[model samples]
Target: MLSEVYPFQETAEAARRVQLNDHLGELGVLCLAPSPGLGVTDATLRSRIGEDRITSLMAA
Candidate 1:
């Protein structure tokens, strides 16, 4: 999903650096839910799209 909308054409680590930070970047529904009976853990979080980006995309 994040692959198409944002074109990371200038880096060697394009796949690793690409993010859904554009308005249409993550063009699908996504939900975050906790796993049942799973209490543990640490996670690395990344920001997909910022509020400004969404607003800009919508206005376009």
Candidate 2:
């Protein structure tokens, strides 16, 4: 699953995964790109990094 935190990096990774999947197809392998979504629990919210900081980073 792809993390929603770093969208740009995740997007690049997903693209690479797609390319890899094409190669894997020859070996009967499969690669799936799925989003886990921006799920921040209460525990995460109480961590050192707040939701606002995470949101700002994501926007960056």
Candidate 3:
């Protein structure tokens, strides 16, 4: 989830990083790498997933 909040060091990265990092620290974990194929190239799909948790809650 850290990758989702801080994908890069670019200025455009959202401020959610601090919150996410803190959350991970509370869980006794730190994200070391980004997931493969996690880049948001499809704006439509990304918007859908971001707007609702249903997509993430559903299982294959």
Query: Quick one: best lDDT, which candidate?
Result: 2
Q: How many residue pairs clash in each candidate?
A: 0, 0, 0
Model 2 agreement with the true structure over 1-60: per-residue lDDT tens digits: 222222343556556666776323221111231223334546755476675554311111
lDDT of 1: 0.29
Q: What is the overall TM-score of model 1 with all chains considered together?
A: 0.14
**Whole-model lDDT for model 3 versus the true structure?**
0.38
- Could you say which candidate leads in TM-score? 2
> Which 10-residue span in candidate 2 carries the lowest summed lDDT?
25-34
Q: Estimate each model's TM-score.
A: 0.14, 0.24, 0.21
Write one digit per residue (lDDT tens) for candidate 1, span 1-60: 332322233233333444634344433211222222222222322134433333212111
Model 3, span 1-60: residue lDDT tens: 322333344324344445555334211111332533334557787787785542321111
lDDT agreement with native, every candidate: 0.29, 0.38, 0.38
Which is superior by TM-score, 1 or 3?
3
Residue 1 lDDT in candidate 1: 30
| Model 2 / residue 38 / CA error / Å | 4.2
